[model samples]
Target: MDSTPGVTIDLTVADQDSKRFGSAPSPIKIGAVRMHGWQVHPISVASDQFDGADAYLVKFNYELGTTPDTPEMNWFELGVELREGVVVDAIPHHTQPTQTSVSYIVNDHLNLVPATNGVTPAAHLPATGETIHVFGVGSSGVRWQYWATSDTGVRWGSRVAWLVTLVDQETTHLDLTTIVRFDQRPTLDWNVLPAVTPADLRIELPTATNPRAEVTTQPANGTTVALLPSSPRVFISYTHDNNAHKQLVRDFANLLIKCGLDVRLDQFASPARKDWFLWANDNIDNADFVIIIASPKCLAVGEGKIDRNEHPGMHCELGIMRDRLQGNRRLWEQKLLPVVLPGESLSNIPVFLQPQAMDRYEIDELTEDALGDLLAAIHHGTEDNSRSPVVLMATSARRALADS
Candidate 1:
């Protein structure tokens, strides 16, 4: 099947009872191969981080391979998936203006794929399938783990990536856009149902001019379904001891994905699973914000045979992202971020989440004006009241405070 126009017919070695392409070992040192394109911006409704919410948070990516002639050991990985759509509103008059019905539904025989790599191995699931049937509205709902991927030697072969968490009940946030597609069908149609247009949806983010999803009824360019992104979706809690601090936290998450932001890492775990600390806590509990690299052998606790705790695997992954951000709303006690390396200590975190703590971001003192002032304090730190830079001058001074 290597006819190789855009390839996707490997079909796991024509299934002669495949055991990883009959036992992986070729040029396969497999590390750097990436191409991007993603969008899952809804960082806070119940809140997580990245403050910018308009909705429809999930768009795939491309070009995951075909550059790796040692393109710096090939490192590009972005994956995101949310296989649950059809959450409707506008049924109040329902006369079919742009057509919106189905007052109740959820996973109507759900089976669609291509969120991105990783989760495609439940017998390769018909090579990344996409939308067969899903219909719901009114009470609109979907969260049964239909899809998710993007982290495993940073991905290759196929791409559409999704893995952002602060406390996912079915994907919280993940925006990745890296187009190059020669073809594997991801030109996107997904059997219609409100596809594309939110500005040609490729979602890597941050250029903002505000034409990113706003269709009250219809026709600005038509098609609707986007309601997610409050801002602050970052999670990087490392410890493989030291591959130079995991390449300095993966070049500090590729400079916050080149300052558009939407990063997630733990070296993309999943080495055919040996319980990599329970699969890196299922992608660090769907991060809104959690970055801990406070080393001293990760805050030492053992040292004889080499069980030096590493702050109990980052306090058991920040206690499962603070118990799933207290079931969504306490936003993990106001979005956690700590980078206190260089001989650690802000008393080693946890002084009630360390009072707005995001200590001087030490990667031996990195700067781009300290990562754009820590990405503008993670897009204006939590409870983002529509990203208050004074809420658009308090809604344009509410008619001069009600005409004095």
Candidate 2:
């Protein structure tokens, strides 16, 4: 084992002249690299030339090893310096992992199976001609670093490089996928360099999109378990407390949407002439989870302190939630979640919901890390097991006794 990570580059395609360049449909040159005892294989690299725009779209698909000896690849960067005649028309976007797998060697036998647990690294175009994607393995979240360039000197051609860094020791793999667009047909030569010192760079703590699905381990026998769908239908229930509060709720909903949740919020609905009450009720019934954002106005409406005519929409939603919970306590209890935003208080939760006795998610900030527990609950249905049925019944009985 080498203390310093070793790098090996392997060009998968040998006949470069055989492949036609520009206008004519041709395959992009694909290559592989082995870094830190793990193999970085380019599964496919497809390129499409624009009809008359003289532009091209390239999609890269790469898979890395996931064995125990595989080093933790913290960040991966793709850079393209355009030729004198070419220019970058658009920044790279739409980066996500398409698939993930795990490999285990047991009893001198090699077994490869699909893994349910994996993180989708966040992609950022921090600077021109540079796109960096990073993922974290532990509690400490992803750290982003970008380079500063004042080198505006004239150059004849551009250079493209793919850099991967192994910052820690962990057993995880990443299936990197991204699409890049160029104004003109550019060279797709990806040069892998060993540990070059980045110049004029600054490390910053940036927010990352939540993983598409929560991480789950496969059984020791290499049995693949069914994982939650990538996008869960989530409905956000909250009162129009104020302009600021409404904006906060909207921001939270947007964040959930970015995390791959099909979020349903009143703010996102159109202002067409229709029955708002029916809309609220229908979404509540159809949603995978209805997140009840805790606030003073929401508590007032849920507890009947506010007049129904004042906030008919919130009133209608609360009525539907109450009916569903009374109809099926166990099911609705798991589906209806009480959430307190950063500036909100837990005491603002509705009384009939048994806020004191049940689990409530407190969001510390408007970041993915703050919503980890809520996301996990939605993905794994763990909240349903948080409290036993017997315990819930006892809590209801206690509430009844207290009211008497």
Q: What TM-score fits each model?
A: 0.25, 0.42
Candidate 2's C-alpha runs over 4 A off are: 1-230, 382-404
Please provide, for model 1 over 68-124, each residue's C-alpha lDDT reduced to its tens digit, 9 standing for 90 to 100: 432221222222222222222111111112332212111101111122332211111
Q: Judged by lDDT, which candidate is best?
A: 2
What's the CA RMSD for each of the models? 19.4, 22.0
Candidate 1 runs further than 4 Å off: 1-226, 242-263, 269-288, 293-296, 300-381, 387-404
Task: Encode model 2's per-residue lDDT on 184-283: one tens digit a residue.
Answer: 1112352111122111211111112312221121234533322122246789999887867976887787667556565777654422334777888889
**TM-score of candidate 2 to 2 decimals:** 0.42
lDDT of 2 at 152: 23
